[model samples]
Target: MALLGIIRRWHLRDQIPIREIARRLDISRNTVRRYLRSETTEPSYAERRSVSGLDKYSVQLSGWLKAETTKPRKQRRNLKQIHEDLKELGYAGSYDRVAAFARQWKAGQTEWVNSASKRTH
Candidate 1:
């Protein structure tokens, strides 16, 4: 959006040539022209459907997080520790994924945090 704004400003306000705009912006002339012609803020992207390395571990992680709520803050395991535990349990995801999961879990909403409300098989 910001890039598109600059492109629009340079083209509509300053009346700069497209090639010059592309040169100054260090982007392709085609890209600058595409944005200049486009009416939308940005081109839409499809949602990613790939399975996460963490997907397999989600249930286990959710259980651990649920159990942690009973512990005092000082006694509760941190994101890194939870991530490390996931690692031991064959979780192939990155620490960021685990940390994100931990944050949502701690919030008591979204993702695995809502698992308690879900009907189990």
Candidate 2:
């Protein structure tokens, strides 16, 4: 790679063809061009450090969400009730956050079950 740097310098100072530098360096012509043209940079990806409150209670919440689906239709678990239940089960978090998590969890499960039911019929 350092040999490429020397070849690159020679090309710059002598106005030699880029193909000459690439062939002597034993690298692709496009790679030589990109190295000559590009600035050093870092790439990044967006990721959360942690899931909000759910990280602590995801397993319990998932179990409750599944239970809600398996219950009789008339006795479906509501967000407020789930929040209360979570509180009773040692969740030391805000009710609103728990309720929000329940809503999203229930929505996803409901969609899955509804799709499966349609497929069976």
Candidate 3:
């Protein structure tokens, strides 16, 4: 949105040419033209559908995370332990991938809990 505003200001208000705007912004002239021509305030992009190696093990990982949440914090297995367990189960992805998935899962869980609490209140 900010970029769109800047592009518009440079072209309409400051009277900067499209070629200059493209050069200053380090974008293609065609892109600058498209941005100027579009009626929307921001450019829209199609959603990407990229697959990850962790997709196959997501259900199992989620189960482990949910089960761990029921245990005492000191007794719960950390992400490293979960990664090793996944390795035993034939997950070939890196520990970083598992960690990222866990972070995203926990975020979603937090959002769900917050929304549920709001509904009850």
Candidate 4:
């Protein structure tokens, strides 16, 4: 958005040529022209859709995490141990992927608990 503003200001206010703007900004002249021609203040980009290798094993991992919450703190499996367990099940992704999923899952659980507590109060 800032780049778009700079491109507009340079061309409309300062009357800088498209070729010069492209050279100064190290961008394509066509890109500068497109920004200037567009009426919208912000450029729109296609939404990104990314799939993780862990997607296949997410349900199984979630089940294990939920079960662990019921166990005594000392006996519960930590993330490393859970990663090892997933490896035994043929999950090829890195431990970091598992850890990230766990963090997201824990966050969702925390939000649910907080919301439920708020309703009761």
Candidate 5:
């Protein structure tokens, strides 16, 4: 819209060349020429960053998560337990982060689902 206004003002009022207008506006000559010659409007540009975590322990996390799926005594460890274990193993993360990841992983376990859903409600 702003580009169209600039092009219209230059072509209809100032009589400037497309290249000159482009240079003065610090936009591309092709963009100015497109406005002067073509019918399509410029599209808006937006970049979307991915949602994946940088510190994903997915592989190790998965194995740990699988162990957690068993009954409390049978389960190798819980998140708080995992957090402590990870700390001992040189993992640099907050208990909250470890807990949060565990919660997400546990979401897939049917046995944990009822308890998690009940807590959420």
Candidate 6:
């Protein structure tokens, strides 16, 4: 967005050359042109990237997470513990992979709860 703003200010306000804008912004001339012509602040992105690294054990991981939600926070399994358990079950991914998926799942759960509460109230 900031880059787009810079391109717009330079092109529209100062009548700067696209090549000059590209050079100043360290971007391609085509990129400068596209940003100038774009109507929105954000770039459009594809939704729902196909994730497969944790797909093999996602169900088991979800089950563990759901079960943990009923337990006290102190007693709940941490990411490292969960990663270790998945490893024992033949998961060949890194700890970072497990942690990242766990975070995404937890965030989705939070949003679900928030929307449910909003609808009920």
- Give candidate 3's TM-score: 0.71
Superposed model 3: Cα runs more than 4 Å off: 1-3, 9-42
Q: Supply the TM-score for candidate 2.
A: 0.47
Say which prediction, candidate 5 or candidate 6, comes out ahead on TM-score: 6
Q: Distance from true position, residue 25, model 2, in Å? A: 42
**What's the true lDDT of residue 9 in model 6?**
85
Model 6 misplaced stretches (Cα beyond 4 Å): 1-51
Question: Residue 63 CA error for candidate 5 (Å)?
Answer: 0.8
The C-alpha lDDT values of all candidates are: 0.86, 0.76, 0.94, 0.94, 0.73, 0.88
Q: Decide which is better by TM-score, 3 or 6.
A: 3
Prediction 6 TM-score vs. true: 0.64
In candidate 4, which residue ranges exceed 4 Å CA deviation? 3-38, 44-47
C-alpha root-mean-square deviation, each candidate: 7.5, 11.3, 4.7, 5.0, 10.7, 5.0
Using TM-score as the measure, name the better of candidate 1 and candidate 6.
6
Candidate 6, run of 10 with poorest lDDT: 42-51
lDDT, candidate 2, 94-114, per-residue tens: 877877777787788789989
**Best candidate, TM-score-wise?**
3
Q: Estimate each model's TM-score.
A: 0.50, 0.47, 0.71, 0.67, 0.40, 0.64
lDDT tens per residue, model 6, 9-113: 888899999999889878899988888777888666689778676898999999998899999989998889999998899988999988888889999999999
Clashes of each: 0, 0, 0, 0, 0, 0
TM-score of candidate 5 versus the correct structure, residues matched by position: 0.40
What lDDT, from 0 to 1, does candidate 3 have?
0.94
Clashing pairs in 1: none
Name the weakest run of 10 consecutive residues (lDDT summed) in model 2: 36-45
